[model samples]
Target chain A: DVKVTQSSRYLVKRTGEKVFLECVQDMDHENMFWYRQDPGLGLRLIYFSYDVKMKEKGDIPEGYSVSREKKERFSLILESASTNQTSMYLCAREVGANYGYTFGSGTRLTVV
Target chain B: DQQVKQNSPSLSVQEGRISILNCDYTNSMFDYFLWYKKYPAEGPTFLISISSIKDKNEDGRFTVFLNKSAKHLSLHIVPSQPGDSAVYFCAATDQTGANNLFFGTGTRLTVIP
Candidate 1:
């Protein structure tokens, strides 16, 4: 089975603080995604990387950025964290075009 | 605008009964549909999936039914158990392009013993 690991299981940051959420996949899947899970909003894609040094913005990418310097690791960056950014963040890797994504355990962020 | 929607926010079912979770999509271009189950403090896990060419797909106790005309899909879990309680989300994707999935809000299912 594919294992997607998040660097932090829980994080708390003050307003205006910079936040970094890291994700690493054991498998060699090319597609990696970041999503925020909010009540009543489901999982909204923040950003995705299809390859090393390549990235694309998703539906909701306003206050977030991503880095995929290497194939095995993908990171999400919040230049200035805010209360609204307090939500569960998930990392997922696409097994294939026609298959389901394998997700990490998730990181619960609390920006106060 | 939300392309996929799960109207019901929560559903309660008695143990040993049937639980049905419904989902609808506004995008007709979506050809692949998937269902995921999420427990508290964990990411969603893949449950089952169906393609546009088929109307029904089943795996053990979980079954998914799709209606192309209405752009609706449903998951049926027979003989519900307490362990089955979780938030269920339905996602759809158009395979023609990037295949990015649009997910529904999700329905929280609680099974009473």
Candidate 2:
């Protein structure tokens, strides 16, 4: 079974503060992704990394960035946290060969 | 613009019955469609998937049917149980190899036993 670990299950940050959400996958998947889930909006992609040191912007990449310095770890950075940024953040790793993706438990963030 | 749409916000069904969840997409480039189930406070987990070439794919009690011309797909769960209650999301991916997925708003399913 594949395991994806998220650093925090819940987080609270003040507005204008920077936030970092970390994720790690046991399986050496080539693709990693970050998404934010909001009510009635579903899950929107923030950023994705295909390989170490490689990154790509998804549909809603504004105010968010990602890092992949290691093959097993992916990090999402919120440049300046705001109330609108508070949402359930999910990290997923894509297994090759049509196996689909494995996702972490997710981190529920609240910005005050 | 929402590329994928799951119009129904919620669905209620009785145990031992079938639960059908529908999804639609507007992107013609998408060739792969997937269904994911997510429990409260948990991340979404992959449930079933169907490629564009195949119209139907079944695994145990779960089945996914795809209609290419209509750009629509549906997931059917037979003999629904209380454990099947959760939010179901419809997702699609294009052929670009970017691994980015477009997802719908999801449908919250409640199974009454």
Candidate 3:
């Protein structure tokens, strides 16, 4: 079955460390997104890629960057992790204009 | 500023009753609306969606209603079950079709037996 998979279910990192959250989709979707879910903030889009090597910043792109070198893989990088950045990171794939998203299980990253 | 908003932070409903979640958006350009359900420690899942042309869309026991004139939309869960309890997020996208969605703060629904 087609799915979006995250490399880690949970991660713990110290402050000032660089963290990478990986996502891969087998559906061959042209659009992939990264979001951070907080208690009251909901899902804030961090970044998205509409095609390979093409990326766009979302509402909350600060302290974060993305790499989409391949069609199936999208990686979210936190250059320097901080306690305030601790949140659940989600990856989603959109197939054309379907208007629905297939989301990964998510990675819960905790910065100490 | 937040383009989409869910005023209520939480809602409680009895099992077998209807649960209604409301969402409002300021962007008139948004033409597609969707609702998502999420449980703890898991990613949110797409529940239902409605286009701007239509007023309502139903799938199984879930239904979504859109009011373009009012810039509002709602999700109704009939005979809400315990398993249906989760955080529901409302999202919208405009005509650009770039797959960019603006999401609300989300409402946590609890079904009491």
Can you tell me which runs of candidate 1 are displaced by over 4 Å? B97-99
Judged by lDDT relative to the true structure, which candidate is superior, 1 or 3? Answer: 1
Candidate 3 docking classification: medium
lDDT of 1 at B33: 95
Tell me the tens digit of each residue's lDDT in model 2 across A15-46. 99999999999987778999999989999889
Q: What local lDDT score does residue A20 receive in model 3, on the 0 to 100 scale? A: 93
Winner on lDDT between 1 and 2 is 1
Q: After aligning candidate 2 to the native by TM-score, how far in Å is the CA of B93 from where it should be?
A: 1.8
Residues B1-113 of candidate 1 have per-residue lDDT tens digits of 99999999999999999999999999999889999999999989999999999999999999999999999999999989999999999999886534378899999999999
Best-to-worst ranking by TM-score: 1, 3, 2
How accurate locally, in lDDT, is each candidate? 0.93, 0.92, 0.92
| Model 2 misplaced stretches (Cα beyond 4 Å) | none
Error of 1 at B73 (Å): 0.4
TM-score of chain B of each: 0.97, 0.97, 0.96
